[model samples]
Target: MPHTKDELPDVLYSAAQVRALDASLIAAGTAGFELMQRAARATWRALVRQWPTANELSVLVGHGNNAGDGYLVAVLAQRAGWSVRVLAVGDPQRLQGDAASAHAEAVSEQVLIEPWTAQSGLRGIVLDALLGTGLSGDVRDPYVSAIAAINASGLPVAAVDIPSGLCADTGRILGDAVHADLTVTFIGLKVGLFTGDAADVTGELVFNDLQADPQLLNGTAFTARRLCIANLPRLVSRAPASHKGKFGHVLLIGGDRGYGGAILLSAQSALRSGAGMVSLSTRPEHVSPALSRIPEAMVLGTSSANQLMGLLEKVSVLVVGPGLGQAGWGRSLLSTAANAPLPQVWDADALNLLAGGQVDLPKGCVITPHPGEAARLLGVSTADVQSDRPAAAHALSKKYTAVVVLKGAGSLIAHPDGRLALCHQGHPAMATAGLGDVLAGLLGALLAQGMEPFDAACLAVWLHANAGEQQGKLGRGLAASDLIPAIRQLLEEQAPCLK
Candidate 1:
């Protein structure tokens, strides 16, 4: 069984992919029954370690291999002198292969097996073995009722494999899923466990590899990588004789009349993140205020696309849509930026405008969209984007021919070349507005500092989330501007420059 602290292998498989892997392993000489036994033993060990004092177990067994795992768990508990009762939701006679063997073993061990009932007195540590990862559509009948009863039982639940009803590929709950206190997943870690609603439902996750053949496991394809500090690109120091001109200039365009703060935030973050020269093209009314707020940035007042064109020549990176309103001025500025050949980072109104088919993206651009923005860009409903974020991100990347950063609970960074990474590190307090703008600026800074678009985005996401987490510890009302210094501090801490 793989422990939580163990380095996650490169391969991350979805439920369907893992099923195919299981079949391959079986075809390659491993018996199907033996694999099932390994799953049960791995689950049992995780259960005992998590709840050592629990002497009784209520196993909710369903119709498939998930039920087989539950039956084997019941037999193991019974042998250990722990009271075990299996509430079978499906007919035991219909069970086939390894599932039938498990049922037979449970029956022979004197483990009580009874049909699921509403008032089954399901006490003690509940083991949810109902649906597993194969479930699609809505959850049906007895399993739904059984899951509800288990939740209401006030007992800590250990879910075998995945919590029943979770889409192993998307992390979306199909109708309803078991709310496990700890889920012991076997064979491989499912992508669903880390994203979408799975984070809430699958608490205290534990992975068990079942001691599968290393060669087979290594050969499987991964869906996405889990983002962490360790996986982030290494930050490089400036050369001893390097000057300000050595780093690229970053041009930030946005901040319509009432939204000046958004662009200012982006520009400030870019400056803090190491852009050589940070410039802001915003509403004429806010120019003086923006300059006063961050004198290091050259704030320009622009009312037309022509004004923006003059500044584009010197910029290496362009960050658009911070506080960009959907007005004529915002649209004109966006059109101007879209025509530029420089690398770009698009956020907020830029994404909304793109969704409306008003502007074409520049080549080598990065679009940072929250779910709503992502949904708009993809021509799908927000529900669709949230339902399967990884797929949505990939779709966005492929459609725009740009690096896509789908921002939400489990933020995803997708490249056009089929590389996808998931960042599971931010806090709930990060649910504030303007943070996405800050991220765009950070990306621009990294680009200005000469990182490739993909690496710049990956590192920026980690740095932005780390800053949010650090500021979030200071309590609520974490203004977007507060993350600026924190990001600068974190970057220096991660990669300090010599004086």
Candidate 2:
């Protein structure tokens, strides 16, 4: 949470794990009350910085330590000459230990405390302290109504720790969740904050350790590591005399009529992302356009599975599924690629074809599937996939014995051995068409360049997402091709070609 020298805090903790950490710190001589006070102080600092001009504050208090944080924040604001009110949704008498102490401190400070009602005056910036990570079921009664009211109040809400009603372990919204304008988290980073519905509800995320001992956290196991530029895998510098043969050739197969652009985008992306050579095998009708679009790539028009055999043998990596129709031709190509020993990247209709149980995915390949494709492959609904994306990603990786890229708001790259990486980058503009095709190609290029399957997937996903983030600032109508140039530039910056 707090930046410690020489340590990049990338571990993501679950709700239960954070509690274990709290207990660990407490057992190690730090009092629970001390941690509570620290959490409150961190929240106060963040709230004041965000709403410095607001002279009034409304703190929604529940029965947990989350509410205790709200109470202490109210005390801080009241002492700072800001008018503060505490709306106690859960009875203050129900609070125990540190939370009760916090409530008593607020009362001593004469912070205006009142029972929450449906018509409670919702004024000033709202502090959502109604729920905590302990919640496991759907929110019921007063809390649900309060969360709904807070959402409708149009007030800038600052959620303490995490937004109420959001699953801390899975990032799923239970019934509903408070849409906070800002959320200040403590102890360790919760995996929920960056994935699934949490991304929509959690505004700007702020973290603090309450300054807990860094060594204590090292002993704890994390749910997943949040992928950032600092911890991302990087490619080593290439020699000046490096030639085309040094980097592996990537053969892209797909583009059944009307989907020619998909394969072209993949081929072009592979070429631009440092693949030594790129080959496109598609319908005969798409040959001219593929050649015209990316003159650097060898365009081959293949009609049957046999034609793909030679191409498959010549390439080090194979990218399948970009605009690959579910017809016989696409099936034939996918079938051929499935048998090849080359490293593979599969997306689009290829995922659908795999879901249909027609083709076997090759070992040590990478499969990128959005939630919809993931659900079909897992024989579940999209809602089920979204409910627990990390689990879904791990499931896919083990099921296929390949690296799995679960593409969505927060893309997850999962290895068959249970290692998982979450990419919290990318922009809304990247929700356009043909991006997955580009990603598959880029991933293939990395694999072809001799990066391991998991490392290549992680690097490619980060590069793809970061490129979209940079290009998305231009606003809207972002085509898939716009990302290729940006990705090329970013790759040079992230993984320089020179020593």
Candidate 3:
């Protein structure tokens, strides 16, 4: 949950965007080889800092410029009195331009170099320079065996730029990927490093701008911006004469016959996150428990679509579908809510129902969908959704004209306006149930308080993920309710009520 690269940049780039940034730097008078050498020096500095006691270096090189960085790291390691060896996974003779020059420099420095065999003895801290960002297909051949060996070695490892076999554009692992202990990435941070199967393989992340001019870094195009405290949307401080009615009222609809807890969690989160008033419309059986748990919220036992008509008119925001089953009663309520023209937050069964084409998603609302739910909505397999999450999020945003919160390790918030933001904050312990419900309600609360859909989602995701990270430190068995208090505290810290 600890963000190793939080000190880096808020901007995230696709593989091609970073390449263009690199090209612009070269075109601006910084020689390509000079940039490579700077990258090597940055990697060398990070390697020594990560494993100070290790004096041996075993570097794996591919045919790309990534290999060029690795070869240069070998030369720097040799000069620093470390035993260094380069395992040529990609033929050194195939190196071009700056990469070929890097190979020749390695040879001139008397660095020990050899072809990589399956039996190659990897010594010291292994440096994975095997593959670079251009990889578009599944891993192949000697590199596969090499990656397998690296994973099997159990030695401390560092990757130059990115871990070999990790798609810089998407976080998908191409067939296989190297698991590194420390990944020293140069220039810009790749969006792939935070999402999908990325967290499993990308260990400690470190970024170096390689001394690129600040103007150049700011001028390039990027895929998404990282959501952090500095860039998160803030709510206006309340006036001293402010009243509860001044803030918007929030209505959370869900909780079928047997699934009442999910909706309660959402309502509870909404109540605590500063909604002026919170309401719950659920089955008659849940009325007593809802009132007993959240006496602050107005709980109504709703059995038919007509029961929600009056309540829908009174609420300012709607949080739909937390445990909303697809039964006739639930469907009736959803159909009613769908036509209310309120700023809605759809999750869980609501998304499933939407995917079933039973109701159209309201424009400009927010839809929070996990990968499986996203696949259903997109009419594709979950694998397809995970393979390229950014694309899926973008597609959903465009299709529904809604603010889409694609929830996962690297949660993405995509706006209909083409603005995308990623939240890298979260804990592994947060993989439990009811979390999405909590997020949906929190987002609704933010919206009720007058934040725009995209702004509310970005802030809600950041707060929820950071709260999960904080509570997750207590270690496993993190309940969905555990995040509510933490989120309230974080919201106060982010945007104080008085000031």
**Model 3 lowest lDDT segment of ten:** 1-10
Stretches of candidate 3 off by over 4 Å are none
**Model 1: clashing residue pairs?**
none
lDDT of each: 0.87, 0.90, 0.93
Off by over 4 Å in 2: 1-8
Regarding TM-score, does 2 or 3 come out ahead? 3
Per-residue accuracy of model 2 over 1-499 as CA lDDT, tens digit each: 1111223368898999999999999999999888988999999898888888988899998999998999999999999998889999999999999999999999999999999999998999999999999888999989989998999999999999999998988889999999998888999988888788887898888889998899999999889988877888988889998999989999999999889899999999999999999998999999988878889999898989898876776888899999889999999889988999888899999999999999998888899999999999999999999999999999999999989999988789999899999877777877799898889999989988889999999999989988998898898999999999999999999889997
Question: What is the TM-score of each predicted model, taking all chains together?
Answer: 0.94, 0.98, 0.99
For model 1, how does the per-residue alpha-carbon lDDT over 99-209 read when each residue is reduced to its tens digit?
Answer: 999999888888999998887888788999988788878898887888788878889999999998888999898888888898988888788887788777887777767
Model 2 C-alpha RMSD to native: 2.2
Winner on TM-score between 1 and 3 is 3
lDDT of 1: 0.87
| Model 1: worst 10 consecutive residues (lDDT sum) | 1-10
